[model samples]
Target: MSDSSFSGFVQSFKKLAVDTLSIREGSDPEATIEGIKKDMTFKGHAAWILIFSILIASIGLNSNSPAVIIGAMLISPLMGPILGIGTAIGIHDVDMMRRALKNIAIAVVISLVTSTLYFSISPITIEQSEILARTKPTILDVFVAMFGGFSGIIAGSRKEKSNVIPGVAIATALMPPLCTAGFGLATGTYKFFFGAFYLFFINSVFITLSTYIVVKYLRFPIKKFIDRSKYRRYRSLLIIFLTIIVMPSGVIFMNMIQETRFKIAVDNFINDNTVFQGSELLTQKIVYTDTLSTIDLYYMGKNIDENKIIFLNEMLARYGLNAKAGEYFPLTKKTLVRIHQEDGSGADIDKKFAEYSNDLHSKLLRDIYTKNDEVIRDKDLKIKLLEKRIYNLNASKKDPYPVQQLNKELKFQYPEVEKYAITSIQLQEFEGDSLKVIKHPVLLVKLSDTVTDEQRPEYLGKIEKWIRIRLNDPKLKVYKF
Candidate 1:
């Protein structure tokens, strides 16, 4: 061979070798993985799987069913594209990476759109614990995705792999977040969208990277690969583009870490200083008001002490936080105390009533005063008439009429009465414009004996007005006979 021809031949051989290696390196492992993915026939299987999983997840979130949620996670088919992207990147196979990313994006958009469609018409609101839980991603979620991807790649590459795909699916939790994204989309909850989409983004990036690492480690080659200088430049540009795209996500990941830490600090402060020691704090919410800070902590019970407040204030001072702390005990519990006075008579009615009234007013939101200017005692009085055993006389309606609805307005009419227990309500059926009648026959209103019979009509008049307003009929009458 001539010198020129020999040199050309050597160059050609080198190019061939590189091309062969690129093709093998880029195409081999993915070929194996892709074969399995392809074997998943049943047209639109992925679409169907995604659709079903989202439905289950949405229902689970609405119903607060953890087991159903886990099942949905297992059935989700989202990891296939995510891992594909990672493998493509690691092996430096631009084409494969593009395909993988496309698939991933398509799957996500489909899942989210499907979920949004389902939730939009499902008649369920986005108020469940699981829905709220996934709406906020912590650093812990990133860690989970990273580990899950690492494990997923390992399992996907193995022959006769033990249900690792399912394990990976559960660990990565791709579906739940997408379902939550749907919830956010439908409910117009921007926070939910922010957190859930961040989580999905984290999983996509870390999983693809992990898959790349695994594919490289496996030495999978791209088949029929052709490398050109122009392609190299293009590849570099794509890498730079992807990096730029992900830069903002890194910022979000950092913010999530900081926010999580702040919440932990607040909880710790509440637990260490509050009277609710060893109690499970139900909810700890921090709100930044326009001019002040508000920290609302709801506990399981209503056990508070004054000393705890002082201690909490000190903690807030240390953090340079000025906030108001409010505690609500169980609705059933009353802190109001009533005092009674006997005016050389039966039960020191004046003095006792004055003490009780003062305690109630102090604990309640409003103050209570009487025209007589006499102090009233605080007592939970249940009228015997309200608790009377009355039978249902009218068979027109069901077993019992709405007694609670009937008596809600009783509060304003009978401020002197602390509580009323409805013993029975008489329902009468009429053929004319009268729909129904509710009679509270034996209501023994609790009042001081000092209250004259003439004053009784005023309270009764208020009760009558309340009933008239609730019935929405001016002619509807209550016969106290």
Candidate 2:
């Protein structure tokens, strides 16, 4: 291509980019400033709306309902004063800034008081996931606030308004954190209170910063002009404030990333090392922390040998999970592998396995319901039919009893025993004129001729105890023939 043609193409591309990205084309700065001023005051309808939204948000957080929280966000007027503060800063209007700050202070107090009252009286006082999520502010939330603020200001300045402001309100999530802070106060959890209030502060500062940037970029006419020295001083103060606000979130985000990576590595290690010859990996628990981390492996069927445990520990180094003698490992100081094995006594092992299975099942159902509620609502009948079919299929399956293994175990433990048979029997009884049938397991054993009649009762008692404990059945009967 010729130089002239390339230059022309570059110029055309630049024009297209500018036209597409520009927000100054249809902006009404004067109208936007007036509108912000109008909305900045907290009184009458706005005050009542703020209180109602606080109540809604508190209830949503209490119940851990995302939909209800979103509804509350839509009606929240908290963003008005925040935008006013940013606009005031952009135009250098000290009066406007004072009014905005005062109103925002009032709004915050009202929100905290109202939410605290609701949470105090609310029966469900448990810390829900939704409330807990707002207590941590990361760099990702900073970006959300920034972009949401940008969209909010741009949409507000436009002559033809759009739904972007409400969308921004939801994205920034300015209401939930306040309610969470209130919950923390009510419950006397200082950690939650400080963390949630810090999150709210982060959102407020970043949104104000974003709005100020947009307003200055559009060259909104200043209400008061100051000397360059004073302007520079103000700018420097703003920069310092922003830096202070952002530093903690940056650290938090880095920690989150490290934790996420560690978890992925742990998962991979578990998957690769799960295939042991005689043992089965029933469940695994991973606890991660900056100071130390631990991985607990629960197995059944056979004990893992020392050599295998040593090898697994050695493999941890390959995954960058091993503890170094003198190194600053921020993700974790050391990764400890604790192995739990099922012995001949099956109660503890069986109980742990059952708990793990139940937890996994509950998590699966929660995820399915949360992510597919709309789809499930549309096909409720189909889902019910499928559930019924699943229940029937499960009911039709035979009870999982290893008769051959139990027989072998019986023979090994009792040398004189030749064979054994086990069966489930129903006993019919009449209780207050009503007939009841109860099912119990019956075990029958055949012994060798060397076993005398005197030893029969003792052997029966011992065998009965063994079978009952092994099968986890209290109502089991044993007979010797």
Candidate 3:
């Protein structure tokens, strides 16, 4: 193609891109700033709204209801003061900044008081998953807050506002974390309180930062200008404050990543090496920590020998879980392996079987069963077979006949009988043209010389009846010696 035609095509594409991406068209900066200022006051209606929203958010978190939490976020007046702070910073308006800060503090106090009261008096003390989720702030949450703030400010600056504000409110999730902090305070779980409060702080700061960026990009008119020296000082302080806020989240994200990798490695190790000749891995627990990690394996059917455990521990180095002596690497933290064996005893087997059966009946297992019904069925079959084998082995180890008890009872009933023995004997019989072997319970009794021959047959018949009744075996035989 000729240079002139190529240049024309490039210009056309650039024009289209600019037109599609531009935020300047139909912008209302003055109106947006005024709206933010108007919403910065925490008055009669706003204060009540904040209190009610906090209560709603707390209830939603306690109930573990995502939809309800989203609803509370949509109705919350929290974004107003936050947005006001950002706008004030953008325009260098000291008075507006003061008002925004004051209103935000009021909102925070009201939220905490309302949520704490509700959670304290409410009978539900359990920390639901929804509440627990907000207790940690990660780098991903920072991105969510920043992007949500950008969308919110851009949407607010438009001549025709859409539903972006409510969506942004849900995305940023400003209210739930505060409510979770209140829950922590009420429940006396300080870890939850600090973690949740830090999360809330992160969201607020990142949202404010994003708003300031967008406001500057949109070139909102400055209300006042400070001296250059004061500006530099404020900038330095802001950088330091942001660093403090963000460093912890960055560390948390790194830890989360490391934990995820460790779990994956552990899963691979378990799947590959957990199998033994006669043992079944019933359950496993993996605990990951910075200092030391641990893997606890629970086995059923047979006990894993010490040699195998030592070998498995040696294999930990392949998974990057075992550290060399004097090593100080982060991922090289030493992991301890503990193997708990059930030995397939009757009581232990029964307990583990009951636990597995209960798990199969649970809602989570039902959902998983829907996806892997065949695999679960196969596992169930294996468990049943193992249980049967264990039961059979246990039966063999136990005495089938209680000779001591039977001898005592016989001696008490018949004073002439000195002692007795019982056992299972195989007898051969001819049935038509085939020889068959049948097993039967046999009882042998030795009588005192005081008993004459005449009393022998009579005592033998009575003893046979008594033995049949006592042992509940109709096919038992009795003899006297």
Each model's TM-score?
0.52, 0.71, 0.72
lDDT of 2 by residue, 333-371 (tens): 678888987574334544545565656444433333344
TM-score of 2: 0.71
**lDDT value for model 1:** 0.60
RMSD to the hidden true structure, all candidates: 18.6, 18.7, 20.7
Position 278, candidate 2: lDDT: 63
Top candidate (lDDT)? 2
Structural RMSD, model 2: 18.7
Lowest lDDT sum, 10 consecutive residues, model 2, at 365-374
In model 1, the runs with Cα more than 4 Å from the true position are 1-31, 36-42, 90-102, 224-285, 288-292, 296-315, 319-481
Ranking by lDDT: 2, 3, 1
Model 1, span 1-481: residue lDDT tens: 9999999999999999988654333334654567534532223877788788888988887777989999998888777767766655555566766676667667777878988887776645636667767765655666788788877777666544458879888888888888888888888887898778877777777776667666766777654355698668866996786566466666656655544554455556565654444333333445432244456554433344455655666566444343234523111111111112112222332444555664533223112222111211111111122122222223213434455444545554555655443334577878698767765433334554555678767765665576556655454443332
Query: Total backbone clashes of model 3?
Result: 0
Q: Could you tell me the C-alpha RMSD of candidate 3 in Å?
A: 20.7
Stretches of model 3 off by over 4 angstroms after superposition? 324-332, 343-481
Name the TM-score of candidate 3. 0.72
